[model samples]
Target chain A: MVKLLRSDFRRLWRSKLFYLGITAVAASVAFGLINNVHYKRIMLNLEIPIDNILFLGTLVIGFAIAIFTSFFVGTEYSDGTMRSKVVVGHNRSMIYLSHFLTTTFAAVFMMVIGTAVIVVVGIPWMGSFVTSCTILLPQILCCLLSIVALNAMILLLAMLIPSKAICAIVCLVLVMVMTNMISPTLWSKLEADPIIPEMSYTDSEGVVHTQPEQPNPHYATGTTRTILQLCYDMLPTAQMYQYGYDKIPKNIHLFPLYSVLFIGVLSTVGACAFRRRDLK
Target chain B: MEYVLTTSALSKKYRNFEALKDMTMHIPKGSIYGFVGRNGAGKTTLIRVICGLQEPTSGEYTLYGISNKDRRIAKSRHRMGAVVETPSIYLDMTAEDNLKQQALVLGLPSYERIPEILKLVGLENTGKKKARHFSLGMKQRLGIAVALIGNPDFIVLDEPINGLDPQGIVEVRELILKLNHEHGITVLISSHILGELSKLATHYGFIEKGHVVKEISAAELEAVCRRCIKVEVSDTKALIRVLDRMKKDYEVISDTQANIYGVVVLSELVLALAEEKCDLLASHEQDENLETYFINLVGGGENG
Candidate 1:
């Protein structure tokens, strides 16, 4: 298993996808930081919260990691390297796990590089955490955990699906959908929470009046709201949405626990499926 | 005789299709075993099963005397390598990097021998060139190079030269021979091109419809396929007597047809047969090649 990991890591280092993903993540974070600095300088209302920047950056980083995982793991099937490893007597479980771990490492590497860019530029432009350091630290950790879980999901899909194009398309679509669905803003919209206008309108008679928007009757309620909340807590993307939007869950540590559980389940299932798969 | 690998009653089925059924074969140590079968006749299926690319639905096989169920079988597989159907190589990697990856998979201490392996496969000069840019033959050779990383004692190649040009085929053929003869490695090579296999095989296994119809050593096949004179004679009883008296090996095909194994003087045989009241109706010499022998053994047709 160690040998397989070593070999896989070596390949990952040389992979263009890995570097491309890293570059993309770095560039995205740098761009976000520069744009935030420009907005701050121009006196725009944009609040560049460090936590929000990091968590929101995951949206782009997650997709990059998805592309990386798909091609990285998909090539095992496409190039027939999976069979070659088996032929050399490496355990199938080991091969599957090594790929998963290496993909996870690649994701973490990209995240770290992206975070570095944020810290370098974000501290100067946006200042430190908007919330307390204790709260911010845990939220950041949860955000990382969420990204790792997302990486596992992507790796699982890539390893299980044999066709490269199909795997990439499916992973990208699934990630995008999951991320979009998990966003707090989307949930808020769905819930139809009343919005209070920031600026009040003045009538022609010089009378000032403010009106709060009514809630949509179609918004989720009762059991549906509870279910969506549960899903939000369980899903890594939903957790990212919570952190990015400053709606940190009370028990944020559970996010990492959920991520760990997901990794365990996905790895076990992926390894078993891969073991029984017939390589052409 | 020591056998490197053997399968007993091995079978594999996919949904409604049975790729292999009750197939049993033995590959002797230090011998080039030619696996002969038509398209979709379970040649690749068998190779995949042995290489652990697929599991057998029933029965079992032993590699280096270790059963498939035994944990030690993985250790035993370390001494084996294979190029099933096509070469399993990373098109994005250079030849050296590919071998290095294989070496790493095998837990080799270092890539000290990668240079030698590349040179052995005639890819030493393919520096920094990704395998995707290589010709089919070069890719195939790189696949072989990957298989040769650990200096395995046994190698299984499924249709190794299926689509190669004459030069590529010769290179692969000579490589097989060198691996078998000079390095004393056991090879299980399957191919539809019987002519090429004949040049390298020390033993042959003919598979038809997922069953091994026959398995014979090269010498035995040679003897069976030797040049012979087919003669139609009247009074086989008289011909047998004359043949026995002349001390020549012969197979009686029917009441009046017999095949003489070696040379025979026509006049002397005719005179001898005449003395015995036997009449020679017709005579012709026939020499059978490997392809004809396989076709005859398995019954000639594309389906076989």
Candidate 2:
């Protein structure tokens, strides 16, 4: 397994996609910085948190990592290197795990580059951290873990699906739909109960009536809210969305735990599927 | 003789199609074993199963005397290397880098031998040229170089010379010979070109429709496919008696026909037949090549 990991890392280091992923992350960070500068100048009251910048930067970075991982792992099937590894006596579990680790490393590497860029440029542009170090540090850890969890999901897809083009399409679509649809929808559902504002109404006798603010029953509560929060904690994309908006959950530690669980489940399932797969 | 690999009633099925059925074969150590079969004749399927790329639906095989079901089979496979169908190589890496990756996979102590392995496959001068830019022949050689990283004793090559030009074919052929002869590495090569295989194989396994119809040594095959005189005689009983008395190897085809292996004197044969009151009807010289022998063994036709 150590040998397989070394070989996979060597190949990963030489892969053009790895460098491209880093470049994309760095460029997106610069773009984010420029946009923040423009927004700050135009609307002096608009304050962008460093956490938001780091988390949002990771969203784009996560997508870039997904694309990088899809092609990186996909080439094994396309070029028949996986079969070569198997033929040379490498265990299937080791092959799968090594690829997973290499991809995870690529994701983390890109995140590090993006985070560095954000801190260097973002600290000056957005002023010092609005949130204290105690809160910001944990959120940063959760955000990085979320990126790893997303990478694991993509790695699973890449390993199981044999075709490069199909794997790339599925991975891209998955990342988009998860972040754009499911995560945000769950987060929106879990938002605190809506506050209905006061309103005045005219009676038939020309008398005016005022109603005070009240909690909207239509908003999620009880079991529904609990389920939504649980889903938000479990979904990596939801974690990213929460961090992007600086709405760090009270149970922030659950994010890393969930990420670890996701990595375990995906790696287990991916290795089993890969073991049974018939290489063409 | 010690066999490097053996399959016992191995079978593989895909949905409704049976790729291999009750197939059994033996590859002797230190011999270039030619796997002769047409396209889709279970050649690659068998290779895939042995390489652990696909599992056998039934039965099992042993590598280096370790059964497939045994946990030690994984360790046993370290002695084996294969290039199934196409050369399994990373096209983005240079020749040396590809070899280094393989060495890493094999858990070698160091890559000091990579240079020697590259020179063995004639790719030492490839330098920084990535494999994707290499010609078909160079790519194939690089694949072989990767396989040779750990110095595996048993190598399986599937259609190694499939798409090569004449020069490339010669290079690959010579490389196979060098590996088998000087290195004493056992090789199992499958090829559609029988003539080229004939030059390399010391043994042959002729498979058709998911089963091996014939397995013969090069010497035995040479004897069977040797030039012979087909004689039509009036009496086989009398001819057999005479041929046996003269110590000749011959196969009695029917009551009136027999194939006399090796050279024969026509006057002596006629006189001997006459002595038994049998007359010679007709005679013709017959010589069979590997392709014709394979076609005949499989029952010649389009399907064959």
Q: Which candidate is the best by DockQ?
A: 2
Candidate 1 deviation (Cα RMSD): 3.6
Question: What's the distance in Å from true for residue B160, model 1?
Answer: 0.6
DockQ of 1: 0.75
Q: Candidates' DockQ values?
A: 0.75, 0.78
Candidate 1 displacement at residue A263 in angstroms:
1.6
Candidate 1 lDDT for residue A99: 87
Chain A fold similarity by TM-score, each prediction: 0.84, 0.89
- For residues B1-304, write the lDDT of model 1, one tens digit per residue: 9999999999999999999999999999999999998998999999999999899999999999999989898999999998987788889999999998898888999899999888888999999999999988898999999999989999999899988989999988988898888889999999999989899999999999999999999999998898999999989999999999999999999999999998889999999999998899999998988999988988875664
TM-score of chain B of each: 0.90, 0.90
Q: Could you list the CA RMSD of all candidates, in the order they appear?
A: 3.6, 3.1
Q: Which ten residues in a row have the lowest lDDT in candidate 2 chain B?
A: B295-304
As for candidate 1, its clashing pairs are: none
Candidate 2: fraction of native contacts reproduced: 0.82
lDDT of model 1 at position B156? 92
